[model samples]
Target chain A: MDADLHPERGMFLHRLNPVAKLLVFSCFILAATLYLDVAVPLTFLVLAWLMGWLGARISPFALLRRLSPVLAAAVGLTVFNTLFYGGPREHLILTLGPLSIWREGLQIGGSIGLRILCVASYSVLYMWTTEPSRLVASLMQQARMPYRLAYAVLAAYRFLPILQRELGHIQAAQQVRSAHRRQRGSWLRRITHYGIPLLVSGIRQAERLAIAMDARGFGALPTRTHYVRTHMRPLDYIFTATGLAACALVLFALGELGLLRSFLAGVAESLAGAPQ
Target chain B: MAQERLDLGLARWTTREIIVMAVISVALGLIFMAYGVLYLALVPLLGQVGIMLLLGFYYLTGILVPYIVRRPGAALVSSFLAAFTELLAGSPFGIAAVWAGLAQGAGAEVAFALRGWRDYRLPVLMGAAVLSGVFGYVYEYFLLSYAVLEPTVQLGLFLVRIPSAIVLAGWLGKVLGDGLARTGVLRGLAITRSAS
Candidate 1:
C-alpha cells in the first residue's frame, strides 16, 4: 500500500484539526439524512471526489480505484432494494415470482446507496489526507478527550500492522512444521494446526504491550503535553463554515420543497397494502 | 535468568495457538468486511439485510473473547479490537466503526454481567446473546436506521433481529468455541475447564 493512503500523510485536509474535521463530517452526514433525497447526497459524493483531486492533490484515477469497493456495493444495494421492497405509487420496472421491482423502491434504494457513497467518500478523503497520529493528538487536544484512552486507540492502531506481519511469520513456521510431520489431513485441519500458534502469539503480544505501557506510567499523569499541536488556520475556519452553510442551505431547500416525508409515506402505504 | 513457569497440564502454546487465533481473527474480520461490503452494495436495492448479521458478530466476539481471555472486559475489548481490525482493513463504515465497537462490546458485557461474572453456563451464554442482540438492535434502529424506517417497521425489525442473534450468532459462537477447544489450543486459555 502507498504511504499516501496511510491516513497520516500531511495533506491539505490533514492539516485541519481532527475535532473540526469530525464535526464537519458529522454535520454533513446529518444534513444528508435530513434531505432524504438522492440528488443532494450524490452531489456531495461528486464534490468530495473533486475536492480530493483539487485540495488533497490525489489523482482522480487513484481516488476512484480506492472507492471501487463502495461503488460495487452501492450497485448491489440498489438492485436488492428495487426488487424486494415494493411500495405505493411504484412503477413496476421488472417482476419475477413473488419478487417485483418497483420504481419507488429503486428511488429509495438509490437515495440510501448514494448517501452511503457520499459519507464514505468524505471519510476516505479524511483518512487519505490526515495522519492517524495527528488525528488522535488533535482529538485529545481540541476535544478534551482523555489522553490515556486516545493513546490506547493509537497503540491499537499501531499494533495492527505488527500483528499482521507476525501472523504471516507464524503461518510460514506452521507450514514448515506440518510438512515435517507429514500432515495429510484436509485444509481445515491444516488451518487448525497452523492457527493455534498465531493466536497464542497475539495474546502474548497484547500482554507484553500492556506491561510495557504500564511500566511507562501510561495512565499515571492527569495531563500530558503534545509534541505536536494542531492549530486551525483561517482556511480551516472558512472550509468548515462553508460546509455548514451548504448543509443548512440544502436542508432549507428540501424543507421548502416539502419532499421530506414523501419517500417514507410511500413506503408505509405500500407496506400496508401488501398481502401478508 | 528467571526460570519460566512450565506446566504441561496448562497446555503452553508452542507457536501453534498464536497462529490459529491470528488466522481466526483475520478470517472473521474478512468475513465481516465482505458482509459490510454486501450491506453497502445492497443498500441501493434493499435497506440492509446484513445489518441483522451484525448482531451475530457481537454475540460471536463476546463469547470468543471471554472463551480466550477469561477476564473481565475481554468480550468488550475483543469486540472493539475486531472492529478496529476491520477499520484498518478499510471498512467503508468509517467512524461508524467506533459506534459498532461500543455497541457490540456492550452486548457481550451484558451477557457476562448476567452471569454475575461467575457462571459460564449455556443458559447464561444464551442470555448474553439476547442482551447483546437487543443492545445492537436498539442502537442500529434508533441511531442509524431510524430516519429510513417507519416507527412500526423499526420496532418489527428490532424484534426480528433478537431471534436471529440468539440462534444464528449465539449458537454458532458456542459451536466455534467448542471446536477451538477441541483443537487443544484453547486449553492454554483455561476455556476448556469452562467448557466441561
Candidate 2:
C-alpha cells in the first residue's frame, strides 16, 4: 500500500519503466545463478549497492537498514554451509573436535550467500522505487498480461491492509472471549482459529466487491485504456543496455582470468565423481 | 440459498472467482512472510531442512485455491499471487519468492491436471502438495546450490519435505476449505455448488 502511494521522486531509476527495470534485474539474477564463483557474485553485489545509492538516490544508511535482516540471513547461510559441507576436506581452514571448516565449504557457502544478497539488493531497489499501479500498467501494456488477471491482483494488493486490520479485530475478540483462558494453544491452532474468521469476512467482502466491479463492467473489454500510461523511453533503453553491458564485461574479464566457475560444470563433476 | 449448477468445464473465470481467490491468497501470503523470517532464525539449528519442514505453508495456496475453485490454472494463479504479495510486502527473500511461487504452483497444478482438473478429493489434494514439494526442492537444488551439498543431506531434505507438504498444505487446505464452505460465504463458488 505504501509502495502504491509512493510519490515518484523523479530519480533516474524511478523514471524508468517497470518493464525495463525488470529486464535489467532479471539479467543480473540470471547471471548470478549461472556462475558459482565468489568473485562473480561479489562483483554483482557491489554493482547492485552502487546502483541503489547513486541511481535510485536511496541513502546508504537506509539501504543498509533495509538489508540488515537479509545480511543476517546471508551470514547464517554461510555458517550452515560451512558446518554441513559435504565436499572434499581440502585446504583446511580450521578444525575442532570432530568439527572442521574447510576452504571448499567456505567458498561454496560464501558464493551462495553473496548470490542471495545480490538478488535481494536489486529487488529491494526495484520494489522501493516502482509504484504498484504503474507495475500493473507496465505488466498489462508492455508485458502482455491479461487485464482481468492484472486487475484482480491489484484489487488483492489493495485489500492487504484491510485484511491486517481484520486480523487484529479477530485476535482481540477471541482474547476477550477467554480463548487463552487455559494453556496457550500451538501456533498452528491459534492461526486456524483466527484464520477462519479472517477468511470468511474477507470472502464475503470480496464477493460484494466483485458484484460491484461487474456492475461497473470491469471486465467488459479485453483491452482497456489507462489514465497514466507506462511507456519505454530512450533512457530506459540506455539503462538496460548499460546495465547488461557492465555484467557481460565483468563476466568476460572473469572468464579470461579463469576465475569464472560455471555452476553446471561444478554440479556435473560432483555428480560424476564419488564423495571425497 | 439455491444451489447453482456446478460448471466443471474449463470455462472462463468470473470476476467473483478471481477476487475471492486473490483475497484468500493474499491472507496466506501475509502469514508466510512471518514463517520466512522464522525460517532464517531456525537455520542454525535445523540447517536448510528447517525450510523444508516449513515448506507446506508455502504450498497451501496452491492446493487450497484449486480445491475450492476447481478451475484450470487456479492453483498456479493463487499461488503466484500469494508470492507476489509477499514480494510487495518486502519479504526477506525478495524476487526469488516469486520464482519459487511459480515453480511450486505449477507442481501443484500437475496433480489436478492429471486428474483432468475435476477431482477435489483428499488424495488429489495431498498429491498436489507432494508434487509441489518436489518442484520446490528441484528449483532450490540449482538456485540455492543444493547440488554442492552432500548427497545424503539432499536426501534428508527430500524425505522431510514430503510429509510436511502432506500434513501442512494438503490436510490443512482441506480443513480450511471445509470451514469456509460451512460459513456459507462460499455459496456462489464452485466448491459449494458441487457439494449441494
Maximum-TM-score candidate? 2
| Residue A178's lDDT in candidate 1 | 64
CA RMSD for every model? 8.2, 4.7
Q: What is the DockQ of candidate 2?
A: 0.41
**lDDT of candidate 1 at residue B50, scale 0 to 100:** 39
Task: Output the number of the lDDT-best candidate.
Answer: 2
lDDT of each: 0.60, 0.82
Please write out the lDDT profile of model 2 over residues A109-132, one tens digit for every residue: 899888888878878888888887
Q: What range of 10 consecutive residues in model 2 chain A has the weakest lDDT sum?
A: A1-10
Weakest 10 consecutive residues of candidate 1 chain A by summed lDDT: A1-10
Determine the C-alpha RMSD for candidate 2 after optimal superposition of all C-alphas: 4.7
Chain A only: TM-score per candidate: 0.80, 0.91
